[model samples]
Target: MKTTVRRDVLTLPVAPTGPENPLPPLRPPGDPHTPDERAKNGLPRDMARQVGYEPLRSLLPVRLLDGYGRKRTDTPLGTLVIENGRLRATVLPGYGGRVHSLLHKPTGRELLYRNPVLQPAGFALNGAWFSGGIEWNIGATGHTTLSCAPVHAARVTAPDGGEMLRLWEWERLRDLPFQVDLWLPEDSDFLHVGVRIRNPHEKPAPVYWWSNMAVPEERRVLAPADEAWRFAHPGGLRRVPVPVSDGADRTYPPRSEYSADYFFDVPDGARRWIAALDEDGHGLVQTSTDLPRGRKLFVWGTGSGGRRWQEWLTEPGTGGYAEIQSGLARTQLEHVRLDAGTEFSWLESYGPLSARADLVHGDWADACAETRARLADALPGEAVDAAYVAWLARADTEPGEVLAVGSGWGALEVLRAEYKLPGTPFDESTLGTEQAPWLELLRSGAFPEPCEVAPPGPTLVSRNWRDMLETAPARPLTEYHLGVAQWHEGDRAQAVRSWERGLERALSRWPLLRCLAVADAVEGHLERAADRYAEAFDDLCQERRDDGAAWTAATAALGREAISGLLAADRPEAARAVWDRLHETTRAEGRFRLVEAQIRYAEGDIAAVRAVFDEGFEAADLREGAEPLGDLWAAATGGEEIPARYDFRLRP
Candidate 1:
């Protein structure tokens, strides 16, 4: 099957321009902030200053006349010449073949230019000239083929009856065909440009495209992705890496400051798929199908210093390229070039998702998934699975899948035990070290002799008890503890028998003697492991109180029981009451808003959940150091196909 390529057309009509005069230099935005402000507020200041850059000058002295009048310029970047109040910019040698600003003849509004290199030093205007009009062509095929060309200048007219100046000269390649046309709208807010490319090759070609523009930092680039790889340049020399750990996989490095000349690349076949985001995740530029994957994926940002000839190539600290390569560094070049006659195309549609704030979480998630899917497709199948497994293993603490019958439960208990320990306290000397400290504290009764007003609590009271146990430690006691640990490891029946024997021996010594609250909690956890929700809830609750950490502990146990009841009985309403109480208590205690959101979602209140997200977004610190709630929310709301815990599958 052959892949057919097409372009979607969009038109923008320019509004009527007021009477024009000799235009003054372009002005910057109203509230132009410094680099520090941009960094502190997460804004992109480079783009906002594009218009105010130096005007383009022409290399050769030239004069052109349209019905409006005559225009002339000398120098390189380009020159602003007007005919009958109509304005057109032509190349002037000193101006460097680049056109900085082109204003409407009547309105004075700026003309928009879109290119893959979002920011290029300059443009090459007038590469090839035919009689009566100018033809602009770009080499697309592997060979030099000018298959597509813009309509001759004679056939095109400025929107306000102004002269159209040829901005850059383009060369057509044989195998690839690319062309862009400027359409001045008679009545519109935007200057419309249409781009087209055609590839008739038989093999897949890797390409990168981007519409390089200087936009404001307040505007956010919105593309699909969980995370973005970001690199920031502080001095214009070395690029730093900042890894966004919040489920976002993009690799952008973090730096303390930013200079100009930052390059970012996207991969091929992913056209207009990535987005440029302002500090608040707002969209700045949208791409069309004409954007080259190689160019679009590879993004470059130059600072005001670079814009001026003063610091060109001066290496202003660490400003370098920030590009997303199609493949790794080694294979990128091969990926960009397509075989002859093979068809390749990139279609990107851009628009604003937000007016003030940056892209939202849903938007970010969608973007992340799209980018990840592309990356996955790029990798080999075996490699993909292996990578995924590695990722899961890194995230998991247990030896086996959390749902595995014997192994999984056992692993969980071992993990919990390890978590409870103070930190790697299981070595040969661990027991001795732990005992020595307590023994010293106990023999001296240092814990009982308090410098503070309140006496030691039951924990300190139980210090003596622990000391006695340590002093007269026996094999049976050790065996009992091991048996209890085994019970926690999911050897339930064995644990019961061992505990019974230990209980008998302990009772023989003292009728009131019992095991630790931790033992009870473990037993309770195991009972619930067999679908005994009520029993488990009761056990955990009792253990919580017995452990003298009742308030929060009981609340946690109640929350789990409520969720379990909801899952078991399928009665959302009853579960909602429990969720509400938990919400109230947690809010009162100022903790776990995400948990509250999960509970609200379980109660079928999506708005409440979203509201919680909004609140969390405002209180950015809350999201820091918090566990993920997406999985729990999915399970509790019946959206997940798998259980949250491994309890059900192991039951006989």
Candidate 2:
């Protein structure tokens, strides 16, 4: 049977991803894996010094996605399916173009975990990440900011002249355009994925890519190496023997007591691959071309906190799964430097492999050998390399049919730089209202201002856009955006000046006011920042229009920040006032419920704080390392044992 690609709908109970936070993420969203001095000293020479060598300063150009709640409803998510009668792969175009399912037709078994629900959790760098399937993480160490964002999708002819699903987007973080082409060869068991990342800029860019696959945790994961770089929560990295670590066989997810990352130290020149097989030695195997040399296993162990995290990421009753990932670097912490005008390309294959149950489940080395032998017999490494070569020839082929539309930022960049991206066209038609003002600035000399009442539009922080905004006529809107751009570029002094200038004639002062508040807090002016936050919230309330829904979301987002700032400044009454002003629905969200507990704690109402937790709540966007639940519990009960349900602490 010839490989076929078709559009389909994956209907599931999906939580609504509400409005994008209007605030620019002036701070790096908490990085759980940030290594400390001890961690830096603990690494092997290769990755030791390079830990956080080129980390993201902040999530700019991209706004935080903290809008999702625990509430879910039946939704039909758009999907694209490709099958060759032997293997079937389902891709969700709307959600990071994730490979949602991989089914082995002959055995009638699902290879990937195949998440039963589409629930957004606070895992992605910019928030809103769902568990399961294969997620293509690019641009940074943490989950890609694009996890919950859409990417441009289209149909293209594969190397074998079959229909291929191509998902491409201009990754905003690195200002690079990348593509992932998925196709299954006729009657072939393996599904081939060709990935390419192009740096069209004049300077070198740090590139990070990890194709993460979620497989059943019950399976024993096997990699080529015996030693792996282990990075765990509370921030430390150590090279430890694989399969066995901390007095236990670490390959089994349930054995570890805490969540961790095991980046396998695959020997140089080894055929790069990782597999997770059941007790019967039947499951998924992912093999990739040499360029993607890194392999990893991420486990949320059997501990209550780890299990709670699993439950938080998906439906409570769902079976747990672990991640088997492949990346371009030796480890996720280290980024490979891609030269200007050059590109990073590789091919990866995913399929099932069956081996002798005794050998697969026996000695560690034997199990690895058994899986490798089965993989070579099933689909040789030479075949994967040859497939990549054939794909490179067709990499530039223009897309035949457009499947889905992503953000217009790529098209905007293409227009700005006249990028000749062939297979993946960021056409001008993709441009929307978000790009309208910027388009005007690109064409006309002036930056058009928004309506006096409407909140400022999204930010554009690329150097090119920043330079443009710097030169444009300095109106309130122009200065407001200029401040954001300047802040993104790490020019704090200039950013403050720009925001302060914008506030001079700004009809809408909340955005600018909130920005200044952030600046003040960063500079250690806590009380001053709180005053600005209160004023900003008040301004937003005054500017709230008849459109209740939009305003409610905006108010909630700004209100949360305002309340937090107020509480930090020891202004409990002021924080309470902002809380009172929030919409009823907004105040009732799990995130705000936690905030309410904080407010009660600040007001010294220990009973009220305890009462808030008695009525259980889950902060959907609970940040990594910010344990409000634990802190609140301790404050309320005076060192009582933290309940298992609220305990998401990664460390003991």
The top-ranked prediction according to lDDT is 2
What TM-score quantifies how close candidate 1 is to the native fold? 0.27
- For every model shown, what is its TM-score relative to the native structure? 0.27, 0.98
lDDT of 2 by residue, 1-652 (tens): 7899899888899998788887788976578878777878746665754455678988888888889998899999889999988998999888899999999998899999988988898888888889899999998888898889999999999888789999999898888999999978999999999999999899998899999999999999999999998988777888899789889999988888888999999999899999999989899999999998899999988787888888887887789999999999888888778899999998999999898989988899999998999999999999998999999999999999899999999999999999888888999999999999889999996899765466667888988889888889899889999999998888999999999999999888999999999999999999999999999999999998855556776788899999989998999999999999988888889999999999999999999998989998988888766677888898789999899889988776
Clashes of each: 135, 0
Model 1 has an lDDT value of 0.29
Q: Which candidate tops TM-score?
A: 2
lDDT per residue (tens digit) for residues 604-646 in model 1: 7787876665454211112111224444445454564432221
As for model 1, its CA RMSD to the true structure in angstroms is 30.4
Q: Report every candidate's CA lDDT.
A: 0.29, 0.89
Backbone clashes in candidate 1 total 135
Error of 1 at 165 (Å): 8.3
Lowest-scoring 10 consecutive residues by lDDT in candidate 1?
Answer: 61-70
